[model samples]
Target: MSNTPQKPVIGISCGDLNGIGLELIIKTFSDSRLLELCTPVIFASNKVVNFYRKSITEINFNYQSTKEYNRLNNKQVNVFNCWEEEVAVNPGQLEDAAGKYAVLSLQTAVAALKQQQIDGLVTAPIHKKNIQSPDFNFPGHTPYLKSFFEAKDVVMMMCAGSFRVALVTEHVPVKDIAKYITKENIVSKLHIVHKSLQRDFGIDKPRIAVLGLNPHAGDEGLIGNEEETIIKPAIKEAKNSNMLVVGPFSADAFFARKHYDKFDAVLAMYHDQGLIPFKALASGDGVNYTAGLPVVRTSPDHGVAFDIAGKDKADASSFLTAIYECIDIIQQRADYDLNRSNPLKKINPEVFARMEDEDIRE
Candidate 1:
């Protein structure tokens, strides 16, 4: 095996075929600059690609089909052709077929990811409701990936430039959100966010700010006691564990004055609390990254737009940003591993031991 480190091989899945999944992928790969960053591989079949190409007016990109990673064309995009069945393509429609094929593509790409065939995965938007099946019963990609990697906890972190926000409770109904905001859950998510910054984003010591669930941060137990009873204690515990975490800050003021810029990442109490501000700050151009996964997985911040699926009005900017974010994360993780393996390789063990003994004797 050649020991040379080349461009990363990025695996992509066609999410909710009836949505704008394929359109975003096609538009992202059309830019030759992305190809220079990483080798692109779409797990969908030729039929799927052709359908989208025909539906859309103008897009230019060629692909070479391959079942294995070694045969991937570095210059051209590669299509793995996970499914060869003849299925009707209906853009802007939510049907069972779309969900089935979406799950198939995701399963195929995840297998490749586990085998180390691809460096990372950038999933297009999948309709949460239609994509539910026996094989995929999770709420969203974050939870499914958490189960696949067997990670204890994973945070759905949205990123744009230096501003990042992670969710404490994702994909849960508003009524049930309060029940999940226990101290244990908050502490676990904070640790994940802290470690992810140090490992994935190359922050040596990450300082994280956490958001409160209630307005005005529960007004110091007057409005709601979750912040004082749950969130504050969780932050204290995380700090005791040597993590640089702070806040039970009111969600309103935190984002209002651009306070998120001061920290490495923010931990929001729920989905809308984190995502609403993130989307506003990013101007609908951000990437959703699954933090604490053994393998890298990111997606566009937006969802599958069935309304504008076939109208060619889908924006590919977020998808392109996701591709770049995956590439950067893969490289950062490798570097983190390299540095973590040994910090004193240049120092002799015998000499260090002798010095310790001398110090003890003195």
Candidate 2:
């Protein structure tokens, strides 16, 4: 076998042709420095790529158009045409055509991921409303991937640097948030978060903080019973399992006090409770990672900005960050699995001898 380390093949799914998905993808790959890290395969047609490239005249985006994956160029960006038919390219439009094609790109990219054609996936943002259909009925990519991979559960984690916030309930209404805040669900999410922190992030012992559902963390049951009944019990269960888990802290005070910096990750109760703070604190470099799945998947933290669809004003920082995170996680998982397979390979002979000497002395 060759000893040379191969660059990972990263699959990109053009989220919505009408949105800023193409714009972001083009801009991100325009940086030649990124090409040295991994090979990129974009799941869209050459015509659509040209359409977006024409609009963004400032960027000199170059790509190789290919229908076959085996002939991909590692030194250049590859556009894998999912469909050859001409489609309307209406920027900032909420038509069904754009949504239909968005689903197709996602499905194609996901199929490649399942077949091991790609090492990891970095998805652009997709509008939740227009992308809905009979075949693709999930609220967002996280749930859709969960069903596609048949994973029992997955955590939607927002990461920027060391600040990571995970959601317990995603895309659900505020009124129904309490019903989903059960001990079982909380424990399950905590388990996923803990494992992801260690495996995906390369942290041996991770510290996690859990947020409360209501104000003041239910004020010890004066405001709501969830913190006392549901959250506290869940924290206790996670702790008993010998995990470094803490809190049922008040979301407002915890963030205001900057308590999130102390833990490796935080688990929030609902959507806004986690994402609202994450978007503000992440400084536009946030990445959405789906943890606990068999396959690695990540996306830019923002949605498809229809208002700035064709405009060259959208920043590619978050998109670039997502791609970097996907590559890093792929490598991290490989190292983690290798160490697990041969635990003795990681132990030093000196350390083993020292332990034996100490035992003899005792």
Candidate 3:
């Protein structure tokens, strides 16, 4: 039997069809080299894909349309049709129909993920406002996924190379942000980040830095007491559990001084506190990864660019990076699980003692 590993089947969710989702997908997978890395299954109809393919005349995107995973073509891009009805494609326009289809694509892809039909998922950008409905009403993908998988909590982590920033609270209003910044919440995120670093990113010991909610970390309780009361207690609790966690660092000085380079990841208090600096430092190639989920999921950091939808002005760097990160995480998780499974057999103390005795005799 061949020992070579089979390519992972990566599920792709078509986000906001009228937006730049299809354009980015077509451009990124148009390169045949990416096919060698993993098999891609796009969750959308063939008609929708052809609609966007006509707009971008520069590259040819050939794909196989199928409804069955058992009959998937591993060497070619597979378009798993979520809906067959002919939908109108308006490139820069926002319509309720587009949102409906986006939800369809997401639901289908997530179903496949739950069934283990796909190894990992790479979602394209979705307009948060348009994609909201009775069935799918969440701020973004992070919360929706957390609800779907029944995870107690999930961290919204932004990644660019080794520079990572996870949000303690995401998609909450500024006024409500302080109420959610409890010591228990911070400690939960720390535990999630710590496990994700080890299992997903292949880090043995990850150093995490936590940013404060208030200005100058509450100026040591003069400005606000979140750092001294909530954040400090949380850090202490995480440290007690043997996690390499530190800080209540002032957000402004941390990024300004490039102090992020010293840690494996940073935990920000809210959405903007972490994302603003992450987007700036990531330089258009950042990926949003939902950490602490049973299944691995990643997406392009940017949103649905309605301004550049049909003009072919969309950059595929971040989307491509998301796909690569998804594949890498799947592999890392497999390696981590294999190493930890049956640990007693992996390290035999008797053999180690015999080897040490032989070396001592010599």
> Which candidate's lDDT is highest?
3
Per-residue lDDT, model 3, residue 9, is 92
Across residues 174-287, which tens digit of lDDT does each residue of candidate 2 receive? 889888989999999999999999999988999999999989998879998988888999999999998999998999999999999899999999999999999999999999
Instruction: Sort the candidates on lDDT, descending order.
Output: 3, 2, 1
Model 3 global lDDT (CA atoms, 0 to 1): 0.91
Q: Relative to the unseen true structure, what is the Cα RMSD of model 3?
A: 4.2
lDDT of 1 by residue, 242-305 (tens): 9998898989999999898899899999989998889988987799999989888999999888
User: Candidate 3: where are CA atoms >4 Å away?
Assistant: 1-5, 344-362
Off by over 4 Å in 1: 1-5, 344-362
Q: Candidate order by TM-score, highest to lowest?
A: 2, 3, 1
| lDDT string, candidate 3, 193-262, tens digits | 9999999999999999999999899997999888998999999999999999989999999999999999
Error of 3 at 173 (Å): 1.1
Q: In the order shown, what is each candidate's alpha-carbon RMSD?
A: 4.8, 4.2, 4.2
lDDT at position 3, candidate 1: 16
For every model shown, what is its TM-score relative to the native structure? 0.93, 0.94, 0.94
